[model samples]
Target: MKAPRAVIFVSLFLLTFQSKAQTKFDHSIWDQILLLNVTKDGKVNYGGFMKDSSQLYEYFTLLSQNPPTEQWSKEEKLAYWINAYNAYTIKLVIDSYPISSIKDIKDPWNKKFFKINGEWYSLNDLEHKILRKMNDPRIHFAINCASFSCPVVWNRAYTGANVESALENQTKKFINDPLRNTITEDVVSVSKIFSWYKKDFKIDGKNVVDFINKYATTKIINQSKKGYKTYDWSLNE
Candidate 1:
């Protein structure tokens, strides 16, 4: 009798704990990245680019600690890491305050700017190790590098449930802006993101032209003669 009762108690405890965890956050945790906008004339002001790396880190750590016992058809871990990488990238820039560009950070050829669960890694590691491992291409839209060339920073937190839609919206918004995308009568120019993640697009049944045409404001779908514009790696500050 005692043994049976003890087993039931443990099961109930586990259920309660799982219930609490599930209720924690329907959405991904987010910290605002404070954007200090500086004008060419030397005027500077906070432009609402707040991002919370701590919240992102803590969430991913939880996912890392316990591989979800529940059946998860959606990508929680991969999406979380993507958000973490982007958030941390911003934090890295803010840590150095007044950086001219993300590349300004001196990452040794051997050591890039990425780390997993506390280990040092390069930006390559985050995309290749975590994101690519998940086999998802939408991630290209979610991870901003704090550069003029990178995707615009989203205002909302990306939760497991909404990450898919969030990324779709992000993709559409990013590729249509003339500042981000340039098209002329003869040639079409796109952001460097398409170049960096060219494989991600091609692997997912898309080419440079195929990818941009989905979001290009113009009805033209010119696959040939497509060119990548020179990127402004300068910081968005």
Candidate 2:
């Protein structure tokens, strides 16, 4: 015996409503937090954060308690995890305030400080298990590791609505920023991000140089030299 027509309609309405609610993850909180603590050049004011750590904790708590549901779009999920990863990295730095580098904490990436969806996650787990698995090589430029060599943290948050443009802009910025990547006419010196995650950049058979050239204003030629810059592990402050 099938359910009544009214019962079926009510069930459908409830399901749609639940899906909409679950997908409505607000990232404005993160935007406000970033605007307050981050500078125009992406430098984080940990000293200011030390005074008001409650907002950071609140953001983390929000992420922990409300993991994105399957109803969320791919862009939404990607933006959420990228923000989470960067936010947690900031938390780690703040927790160990006055440290010279993120490396100052033993196995910083492996520490299980992030609780999400009833499971604990470390920075490494989130980056490798989730973000990387998303198959978007551009993520390497979006998730900052709180190091000088890491991609510059955008002054604003990554919202699903703007994530695509944000990622594109950041990739271009990182490639063009002389401090992070130097693209000369004959030589392309780049951050270790490309060397470390070479395979990720090789999606669709594109090599590291091909990937870099996509955003490099100088446009590396076929025979141009490639060199990896020494990674600076010092705090990005």
Candidate 3:
């Protein structure tokens, strides 16, 4: 005795609704965590994060349960992975709190400290294997390495709807930030990020200067001298 057609239709409708709801991963927990522990200048309070570690744990569980799928939009994938990368970096720091730098943890980036969809992943896998493969260089700015010279973590969570603008803003802010780069028409001393991942910034056959000029307020001349500043690996806190 099969169920009535109306019953089958209603059951299907309910299932679809639940699926859609679950697919829209919430970032409110991560957002609140950032608001409470990160400064507007992007400095992190590891002590504060450690004190509020439960929320961070909850947020990590949410990320693990809602790993990106092919059904997700490009922006959705970008936002999810970027947030996971930053939040997990904070977790790494606080778990080993009192360290002067993330490098103090042996094989920090290689440690598989988190999971997404039941698969374990290390920071290097997330950054190099996943995010970099996404083909958007602005991610270099969005994902923080918990260091002084790395781009500061934005004090807000990114949503798929807002990620594009957020990436644009982060890139521009990092370039114009005098502490990160000194731009002049004749010469520029920029972050080692540019030197390390120069290939990522050279878009459409253009050179790295072309990419820098896209965001740098003081545009570098075509023939400007270029040099990389020493990266400060100290904790942002």
Candidate 4:
């Protein structure tokens, strides 16, 4: 039997409202925590964070309890998972403070610790199962692994409203930052991130170098030498 036209219209309106609400997630708590803990140069003060661990746990609890629903926009979901990955990473480090590297933990990325939407997730699940599947190479720049060679941890929380701009800024910042990528007229040296996720950057028939040149201030001429910087697993502290 066909539903009434009024009922159908009301249902559509409710669905639209729910989608908008999902996109309006509050990231202020995460933003405040990041501002206090992450430095301008992207180094984290694990010591300082340990002192205010309560706030960190609060953010984690908030995330686990309020996982994004299907009604949320793509950007909203992406921002949420990215924040979750970074936040959980910080928690893992603080849980084992005074540690030298994330690798020091036994399979840290695979450790199932995050509960979202009633399912427990590992860091790998967040990255591979969710973020990577989103098909945005810029995500590599946005999600920090808490290591020296990894992308700098941004000092602000990523919100659905700001995620697009935030990602573009991060991509530009990372590509131009000499510490992350060295681009010149001849050779182009990049972080191992490019090499590790080579497939992600291949968009519209562009290779890795092509992708880098897009954001790199200094354009590569010949693209002769491409070297991957040694990934420093030492804590970003």
Best by TM-score: 3
lDDT scores in order = 0.62, 0.88, 0.91, 0.88
TM-score winner, 2 or 3: 3
Candidate 4 wrong stretches, greater than 4 Å: 1-19
Candidate 2: list runs displaced more than 4 Å: 1-11, 222-224
Please write out the lDDT profile of model 1 over residues 49-139, one tens digit for every residue.
3234455456545544444234444556655666666656655676666667768877622345544445666666666776776766777
Question: Which stretches in model 3 have alpha-carbon errors above 4 Å?
Answer: 1-5
lDDT of 3 at 7: 100
lDDT assessment of candidate 1: 0.62
Using lDDT, rank the candidates from best to worst. 3, 4, 2, 1
Q: Flag the better candidate by lDDT, 2 or 3.
A: 3
Model 3: colliding residue pairs: none
Residue 109 of model 4 has an lDDT of 93
Taking the tens digit of each residue's C-alpha lDDT, what string does model 2 give over 1-237?
Answer: 999999999999999998788885777778887888889888988887766678778887889888878888999999999999998998889888899999999899999986897798999998999999999999999998999899889979898899999999999998999998887876667888887898999878778888888888888784447788999999988
TM-score: model 2 vs. ground truth:
0.93
Residue pairs in clash, model 2: none
Query: How close is each model in CA RMSD to the real structure?
Result: 5.2, 2.0, 1.5, 3.2
lDDT per residue (tens digit) for residues 1-237 in model 4? 999999999999999887776655788888998899898879998898888888888888889888888778898888998899999999888888889999988899999976876898899999999899999999999998888888899999999989999999999999998887888766678898888899999999999888888888898777667787777899999
